[model samples]
Target: MSPLFPDLALPVPPDRPALRFGDRSLTYADLAAAAGALAPRLRDAGRVAVWATPTLETAVGVVAALLAGVPAVPLNPKSGDSELGHIVRDSAPTLILTAPGTELPAALGDLARLDVEDVDAAPGRGAPYAVEDVPDTAPALVVYTSGTTGPPKGAVIPRRAVATTLDALADAWQWTGDDVLVHALPLFHVHGLILGILGPMRRGGSVRHLGRFATEGVARELNAGATMLFGVPTMYHRIAEALPTDPDLAKALAGARLLVSGSAALPVHDHERIAAATGRRVIERYGMTETLMNTSVRADGEPRAGTVGVPLPGVELRLVEDDGTPLTAYDGESVGEIQVRGPNLFTEYLNRPDATAAAFTADGWFRTGDMAVRDPDGYVRIVGRKATDLIKSGGYKIGAGEIENALLEHPAVKEAAVTGAPDPDLGERVVAWIVPADPGARPTPDELAAHVAARLAPHKRPRTVHYLGSLPRNDMGKIMKRALKTDD
Candidate 1:
């Protein structure tokens, strides 16, 4: 009913820092004035595109669009020509917003460019906002999903969804205005943009972007009054590697109130190592492009190392089978596909009514396609994606996440990803693509299999092991499992 950022429009202290990126920082007053300057221009535009470059311009541009009651599309700077072209053409944005020095790719050449820096960002500079016009159901952003299967689809996120999810997380994480979030994630996706940037703003909290991910940057911000840390598995893995020799890094991490990891599973080994050094356990949360956030390990709840924990406030979650029937049990072993229904869901896949229609069930629950087992205590442990992570091996339904975690526990393995491959007798067999800890002294397949078998059941052990210098990962450090599948 009200503007997403009600506090931003109100008067604030001149010295209160709202955002910081590297050396550049903006006070809450600075952001409000700048966004208000561009709000009038965006109010009448069909939809504006933002070159999400982890800069002040990108943040101000998106916030301006939100204030203007216009939809903003965040284009990934790292997208290739084809991906960029597809998005630009699909979203059909009226204009593209970027920083002064940004050299946009050829794909964006056709769109009119609005250089945000050139605009006046002086304190108390812009006209008054008409906040009463924007409705709760209006689209706030059109975020494109990772086009793993085909051309990326735009998920039309409503203002209400963003407001609901953020408020829910505030309750779950005990997040407050006093907290300062430190992260180096790209602003293209939900994790980095909506939750990482807009999330803090919604709480009237401050955020410090690391320009790019570095363990030193994380340590520096955390040591300098940052209460919470948000990162992907890759960043945490690096922190885990650096913790033994870096006392300052460990001390800074230990002093932080919360450390959250998502976008992909953080291996149990990394969790243990970080916990061992910092005396802090990294909590995990689960979410998707379609659903802003489904579940999270609560701040006051048990911080289970491998599980993503229970559903957030106002979110209704369930585990269903391939038949689309909801599972009745929570045995913590029965693997079922996760389904959720709540206000925190996307309205549709832009211009794809059929695709959007298929994403939800008859009863309106969005099928997540992620397979997981729920503990009796209500925590959800994601095994893997239903399409790739679920392995039917020798009549057993196996979740690759557990097996991958087991493989990571091995001293010889540096990184591990598990996927299912065709087998004549077994239907489908568990296959592991491993990045060995020691390239010269690789662990034998037998040793790895034995190790996994001892921890899990024999059926869950990898039927085949493939070694590589590194696993293929996307921008968010999520392993490209489909890429691995295609490799075979």
Candidate 2:
């Protein structure tokens, strides 16, 4: 493939903005001068850890590492000591790059540090980078993703995977250099770093990062010529809540070219509310860390609420039975495990060959462990993870995502999550965890059961209901159902 970023190497308009974090911003020339100067410092350094704090330095550090043909591991700033320690030891980087004033956790205190501010961004300070030095098979990043056992596994992502995923998304989203994207997502994970930041740079476009998410900040940027907005379901939910009181937010949202949501299934209720107020439907996409991006609702196609559109270009996707046979009939009801094979797939789990080997089939398709069903028109609607989402109660298999979406439609329900728990008669019964819109007049369990039963079938209704002040969520705003199930 061509260079990861063609424009970064050659000279561009010095005044053209490339990255902005709050009050600090970097133009195209400034980015190249800084990343290019620091690229040589990372040339001999083995895998390096970037103290990812959603700042300009973190972005420049990762880019310099990529330019130097070395694997960069992004460390989450909010990680606890135990979780942080595990990643540092597992990745074993020789260097850690941080912003000038940021103090790293004790887990990374031992690594040799290179503060980006200390580096001189003088033009022609270092030898220019050769794209051929990094081949398609060369490992570009070792991104850590959560797992059940031990700690989060570092997925070794190759240059080809990054190149192809971005190219495919460009075709899918009609993304171009003219598009200016805005988001406030953290810099640690794929959703933020890869898609949110790097995707813009690769397209030779500019990105404006909200130091943190707020409806007012989103409106300010979107109203100021930003065409696209990327966010998770929680951010979108907040937008839906503020739409009535904030007409400026609604006007800004309606004026944008695209508003995309991911990392979880956005409840259909939020989707409807946003569209009703803005007259613009927020699109949903499906992907995982190991697989950079699998599918997205096409920019020109119908913006269906729940479905994450079709498989992205160059990605081969299929729903498989437990016996490993691909499901043929797409009747919009048959549920199966999702298996995908593509150049976009990560190389392996860092230092775990056994887990890597088990993740794939004999034929080479990677088992996603995500349960989903395909509509007759080929839209894929993910129900939930196979481990936590599928509920086989009373001899029928049901998807928690669908039931949760239904519950959110209730006037009293503010937030909802559905899970399967052990039952006496039914092998596993559906349980609902709800955050009511009104605490004083919360919907009764029987009322909720009846409401769900009337909308869906009787078997799909929750067997029990529990009210909560709010649901526990991860940094990406995904509901932690595992925490809910174990009461952790």
Candidate number of the best TM-score = 1
lDDT of 2 at 86: 88
Candidate 2 positional error at 16, Å: 1.5
Q: In model 2, what are the clashing residue pairs, if there are any?
A: none
Q: Per-residue lDDT of 229-334 in model 2, one digit per residue for the tens? A: 9999999999999999999999999999999999999999999999999999999888999999999999988999999999999999999988999999888888
Candidate 1 stretches with Cα past 4 Å from truth are 118-128, 485-488
Against the hidden true structure, what lDDT does model 2 obtain? 0.90
Q: For every model shown, what is its TM-score relative to the native structure?
A: 0.98, 0.97
Weakest ten-residue segment in model 2 by summed lDDT: 118-127
List lDDT for all candidates, in order. Answer: 0.91, 0.90
Question: Any runs in candidate 2 off by more than 4 Å, and if so which?
Answer: 118-132, 486-488
lDDT of 2 at 250: 94
